[model samples]
Target chain A: QNSDASNEPHTVKKSVLATYYHRKFEGRRTSSGAKYRAKKLTAAHRTLPFGTMITVTNPDNGKSVKVKVNDRGPFSRKLAIDLSESAAKEIGIYSKGVAKVKLSYTLE
Target chain B: QNSDASNEPHTVKKSVLATYYHRKFEGRRTSSGAKYRAKKLTAAHRTLPFGTMITVTNPDNGKSVKVKVNDRGPFSRKLAIDLSESAAKEIGIYSKGVAKVKLSYTLE
Candidate 1:
């Protein structure tokens, strides 16, 4: 049984350290732990530790929001981060779908 | 003693049942419980019970993903639901700040 584990293909590779976008869905859940919430100003970075704060900015409108890194994601190839519906609207990203954004870590 | 509790400004009001968008931060955390992860294909809604599954569809690209409603949010007047970074990219919501989408509650 242990031999088969090594034979499995490691499909997980880190893409852009992180990316940004509006509200949409296109990923799968790998862990079965507790769920995360969208209403809270939170985000998911693959490498960032949980509870890390990051500033998310909308390049188009120049609107920015500080979010706590609570989860992990952007599992697909087409998008980056998923904004809560409210976060997208607050930064003026909901109209078009996805926006150019920059996420910077906030020192705790 | 309890009179002040209810007298306190009831600023909390329901907005749009729910909404959609890309990666951004524009809300606040109401609870101090365990944090939510964005990369886990999860979302936050005000009324959805924990573990409720919902389908988030990107109206622009027509991509959809199923997510579990695990938190509450959109505390600001700007956004609706927040997406995980990965989910946004998968559904093509990362390019735009936010997308026109529909969230349907899945019957468990």
Candidate 2:
């Protein structure tokens, strides 16, 4: 049974380190051409298309927030998503500065 | 003072009819190529750029929800914005099927 399980196409939930956008970037144009707003629920992902909606969950507190992918990067090899200030707050990560998160998306 | 006010570039908040996306479209592709999820806090605006975030306010109850513009159109001349199911619920419009809302966006 263990060997069969290993051979199966198992879907593992990926966890990544997350950080948030700085207020300094507010009003600046993101790579996708939309002006970044710190108060908006938005995020930056390296490969997700602009307008992609993602659920970012903070495993520590079981809090989660939905953020739209509108810009490009955290630029750090260690991070997976860069959320806006409001997005981070929604998931209880604003006060912490950073958190380990699991990302989820629905397939079409 | 009235003449001066008339001459000034006065910004008037526009109010329009708003509706929510149906759950049947949950996994379909939006105009921006991202998959639509009815539970996400997103909206469809005719002219707004993809990824633009707008504050949708339901003036009757003074409730509001921030939504990202990810798709296009109510396709009706009378409607201004179409919220996702969750967005509609956030602003207390989900049960009504439609609501009159004021749209606001910040300039860069």
The candidate that wins on lDDT is 2
Task: For model 2, give the RMSD to the true fold.
Answer: 21.2
Q: Where is model 1 more than 4 Å wrong at Cα?
A: A1-108, B1-32, B78-108
The local distance difference test score of model 1 is 0.42
Interface RMSD of each: 17.9, 22.1
Measured against the native two-chain assembly using Cα atoms, what DockQ does each of the candidate structures obtain, in the order listed?
A: 0.07, 0.02
lDDT of 2 by residue, A1-108 (tens): 123334444322344444555446768776567887766777665445577665555444445556677765544333323333334344444455445543322111
TM-score for each model: 0.27, 0.32
Worst 10 residues of 2 chain B by lDDT: B99-108
What's the lDDT for residue B11 in model 2? 30
Q: Residue B62 of model 1: what lDDT?
A: 43
Q: Candidate 1 deviates by what RMSD? A: 17.8
The DockQ-derived docking category for candidate 1 is: incorrect
